[model samples]
Target: MRTSNYDKFPFVPVAKAEACQTGWAAIGAALRAALPAHATPGQPLVLAVECYPGTALGPLRQALTEALHPALCLVADDLYRAPADLDALVAGPLTDDPVFGRLNGLTVRDFLDPQKMQVAQATLAAATGQLVLVLGTGATLVCPSPTVLVYADLARWEIQLRQRRGDIANLGSDNFAEKASLKYKRAYFVDWRAADRLKKQTLPRADFLLDTNDPAAPKLIAGADLRAALAATVRRPFRVVPFFDPGPWGGQWMREHLDLPDGPPNYAWGFDCVLEENSLLLGFGAARVEIPSLDLVFAHPRELLGEAVHGRFGTEFPIRFDFLDTVGGGNLSLQVHPLTEYAFDKFGLSYTQDESYYMLDAAPGATVYLGLKEGAKLPAMLADLQRAQDDPAAPFLAAEYINEFPAHRHDHFLIPAGTIHCSGAGGMVLEISATPYIFTFKLWDWARLGLDGQPRPIHLAHGAANIQPDRTTAWVQQHLVNQVQEVARGEGWREERTGLHEREFIETRRHWFTGPVPHDTLGGVQVLNLVQGAEAVVESPTGAFEPYVVHYAETFIVPAAVGAYTIRPHGPAVGTECATMKAYVRT
Candidate 1:
């Protein structure tokens, strides 16, 4: 096995920073220093500690109250609508479905009770000569104009971990004992959407950006410094912090290859470039501040995504690169993504997940289930799936109806929306696709239970509505499997166009080289993974940015503003062949 060079906590260095305070003592002192100016003659100084949905409020409230010795501290949870009322308010968006829900147009203000907000405001108004801190998820809604606004940020991945640990609950809900998957579904469809909307509105005006991912250790940076760091990052190639998780079908590849710690049964998913659920770290001297990677997309969409992509998808990062490792494990659930019209009509999604499985490493006899077998009927397959789900003793004979293709290293299988597909066991797949990743409708799960010991949720009705009967063996063989064509070649490198199918908006390119290969973003963002060799260094043609080194299986992003860069073998892979698979939105 190769020595692991995978950087788990990659951080971008901030060029200029006034200060990065660590822990509550330093942060509170800094806030206290800034408080004298905002203090009034009669009313108390109102400090709003606005938080993302999953921030640890106990430590935050305790630490701040101890440090500031506030005359009165109000938690936003106290001002929110009652639990039943809040549930009813979000029930429309968070449907009864266990996994899928409709995207709603609710904002953080909708969760706050106006009468309670007025009461809090009146209390703050009647306060005397001391600090009055307002804290919690919707703290800003209660005190819009505060003496100091500190936006406490937490990454979505950390939030998921907390959810699984039962350390935190969903926004305005006391269902900590509920299943993590159900909590995640609610957060995805309701909590996060509302929190993110508030975050976008409050970040620009925030005086301090708090890194609250860690309960014991908190890092604080000036809001301007955080914004500047994000702006600077767009001009250079960088990576978000990758997080891994185990599943029922997880494998040992990541634990062995990525130098992961000994925990969890196995590593099933590696989120390398899913900005919505990843965190971006910024370096301030010896300290690191963690914030949601989506902050960058929201803060500088045009600069990071270019005019065309930003205009087409708004502030969303349209592409994602992640890993599905099933080596020495079991098969993934048979699934299909919804068609665009079906996605919009049913789930309120503007787009669907059109993805491809690029084999990073495949053991002998590894296979990928793609599309359908010739003469396979949807009704028959659905019936079989329903029967298997109904009675676990009778397994669904998947091979009879699904096309299983032999998978090898570097094999690219395109799966457009409505194409039923899954990665079989014994392969490490680099899944490159559109960013609407959670819209998958699982048709079958091999009649196995989830890690939670419950039957995994199936969407047969949703899947039956979207699966394309025409994507049979013949069509898939001609269009999807390993569709590589030589696009260009240089002295020691060659470029190939890999298929994402004509129906998909994302285009993929593969380059194999023992020498430097030039690349440009073509006025849009690009996501690339080093699929071969040990390591490579990405450099600028005009010294616009410093050289960035990436290890094998590491996915990095080059923003549209970067313009041009070159990748060449570095370190142990100097003379060895190296290959990179890059994906970008087709313009």
Candidate 2:
């Protein structure tokens, strides 16, 4: 319980097996010794890091630190720890933290580095019979060859992270590492064509190997644990190592190495991407691929399409669930998602409207601009946008452009095509919706960009054409807000028309853990994405979880068309509330 200046971490502040220490380097040293030795030539001891509180390290952090203490035992040469203590960890010690308290019996080496870890990788590659797991950030690689690195930016990270406010002290580098480490994971793999290029210089790439088809895909706890599970599941020896990038190595390299036409590749559409495992994209795009295996993803729509598509497209595309953390916030443009006619007529964009906001957490009183204010004038609204450019920030679109709504926790706002809105600051929102192809307008914005230092672009032409003509501003106020009611338990789900698409969109509503949930995919798949809870679990044949599985704050895609799924909630079991929306799945 000893305390000190570093209140951020080492929360316990316990004297080292030796003496008091300072600095991350010293911490790293203590950590290094705790791990097992390198296996043969390429394999190294693996470890998994559990998160904790106490920014400066103290009681809170120590309370949260996982398995590291036991690993320190394994490094007795450096830690001066008792051998028995190490044994204690092998039995159970990683579960000190409430969120990750279940994994106490894992070994020390298994604490920090897991499968794909350089150490674990080298070791597993050697055993011929056993599998090794390694976990790491992007910086661990020191390559010396010519290899192809595929960097895919999936998940609506930029969109959700936009709500972080000034909490992003480190800008792009620091912020990216934190959020990226938390949700955006990495996976390392060896590509023969890519091997030569990366022989000497290790390049960054996306983790795209986790097969949605793998029965164990949904069972994976998080991106960090993905390797250990994959290794344990696979029977054959896999030379391919999927690495997780917890640092700037992959992001920086991805920006620099990508084969952009003129400028760097612009991360256009939103999709989910993990830096662990063997693959990154749920679909395919500008990223590089190893062989014909991933090529077949396109022909299959049921694999990619979600609740949104089946309701319209008559099919699904091979796709995984998309999770987002809107750290920063902005007013979504005030506009209507045109019916299929407006989509094909106005701008030729495919699906419009159809957006869901699953708010995980937020500061008190922070509001989001949802559809037009109750009973407002459409003529005046259009007049305002036309005149919005009159202000100095005129060109600054996407700002307080849409109708502003005060948003609090569990507040679900459905953005049907034609609804004018914007996500204001002061919240971390989980944005889920149709296949992200229908953002039709951008009228105002104070003009902002990601930590990378760039101003967000606006599409006034596209946005303007989508505004509902007879805007009474009362559509949502009258129908949407009024529809809000106590979640009826036993329904297993809820339904309602959000906007113009009749039944095009239906957000899911939970009365907070009434019973087991149904799992199936009509449009694509029912995505049980984690909007708030950590350790959220869905019982599907391919993916499995511990009894009373934990629903850590991470969104997961429950592939559409599957049989009924039993959804279980963890983490205080929604003691407070749950995100609201009618899940728009195909009938």
Candidate 3:
């Protein structure tokens, strides 16, 4: 099932009524304001309405057409390629093995035929009406020219829900990843990717943006003041929509604490910080709507990421934070991510996951396997991995090759890409790293079956190609483990450097205090976690906005526009201290 945490407090930011007004009433008001004072009957008016898959376009089309009489409603699905051609495209070859298997081949171009689309456009253009409503996926792409371009969007999770509920026209009977009995969820992947790509291509050029995330209370972004809305949004502290997924090595920490969906299989990973697959929720009264976090990067890079950083990385949000929990669960698969150049050549990614594990909590004897033993032979290790892969009964000599160190609360273990590592049982780890995360080349998985009751895919060849031989036990100990050192201090607070891995462009620092910590964004974006104590308030020096309250274990961002702010620890015992982990690009 799809998941999101924007509905919960402590994760949602303060909302301004001028920028975010909730409910279907908001959409109705915006639409009325945007419309012309009078409609000329029999005049040609093009309204290109683009939507994600699983949207009930028929109802929307009917509603709009009735509202504007003398209108012609043209459904794009009626113009799609024949059923046989769609089936062939779904089974066609993909650019690579999808990060999420079976969902790779789904794309906008796959389900469409260029010649037929052009013909449909011409046919629609020739027809006469007061309003020509072109509604469906790729509507803007084929409308030739539209008077008003409407990007009607729904969150991926909501779309998935509708698909499961048999509400989507084509995807109703098709199987998704969870319902796949024999093969992969090929059908769902194709539809999902097609909708996703269409939204990406159309949203930027949309004259009016609409949110159907809550079908009961649709919202609209229509006005000459759209830029101001975006600016107002970027100035506030916010969290990306959080989601959870289950895996073979999954734990119960997130499910137990975050009010996540209790499941047949426990939640293994929580996407607390991610951009490519995450979204930002814009809150209005009793209504929350979201846009992909990439929209902020694309539209207002300078405000969110400062001039120096926006110049260096462009629109890319380089820092990522996620959770790796093995508490009351099994060990993670021993893995290494692709090196920088390797990732670009093979996976088309500009970055790699050069990560660090900041332990939140750990049980007795918890361990983390990092780096290789000093004299470990690469060829012998490769042979053992091959044997394990070829014969499931073969032994995995994990201890001989990997150095397992005892883990503790507040410990930070640096793991640059190409280093073999995994978190063992009984620890809750906050994985802070560079943005690219899906390229993990897993070498071993402890011979465990995945949630789908199948063996997870192994990547020995990729791992061997990318593993760095110099990251030995001695090197890891000297350069990676618990390398906390004092950097600066003030009246009642101090700063310490915790993670500054040479391979990563992002660095992490810990601020511990009993009172206020005077700080500035320093011309760059900062992501922070209140890892200790109950609560804290971050306020601007000018008092231009409300004090942003951050709760324990919750993450929030401070945009560069916010210049300077002070962090005041709250709800801690009189003389006790609290701590926060702040991460940002080195620039």
Q: Against the hidden reference, what TM-scores do the models get? A: 0.98, 0.45, 0.86
Q: Predictions ranked by TM-score, top down?
A: 1, 3, 2
In candidate 3, the residue pairs with backbone N, CA or C atoms under 3 Å apart (3 or more residues apart, or in different chains) clash, namely 106-190
Best by TM-score: 1
**Deviation (Å) of 426 in candidate 2:** 1.4
Give the per-residue lDDT of model 3 (tens digit) for 17-90: 55554454565455544444433355457777887666677667766665554256677766677766765665
Task: Give stretches of model 3 more than 4 Å off.
Answer: 1-34, 37-43, 53-70, 77-93, 96-112, 156-207, 223-227, 572-575
**Per-residue lDDT for 396-495 in model 2, tens only?**
3332234556667666666566666655555445555565332345555443343355433345555566665443346555554324555344554432
Return the lDDT, model 1, position 16. 40
What's every prediction's RMSD, in angstroms? 1.4, 18.6, 4.5
Tell me the lDDT of candidate 1: 0.92
User: Global lDDT of each model?
Assistant: 0.92, 0.34, 0.73
Best by lDDT: 1
Question: Ten consecutive residues with minimal summed lDDT in candidate 3?
Answer: 175-184
In candidate 1, which residue pairs get closer than 3 Å at backbone N, Cα or C atoms, i.e. clash? none
Residue 460 in model 3: shift from native, Å? 0.8
| Model 3 error, position 537 (Å) | 0.5
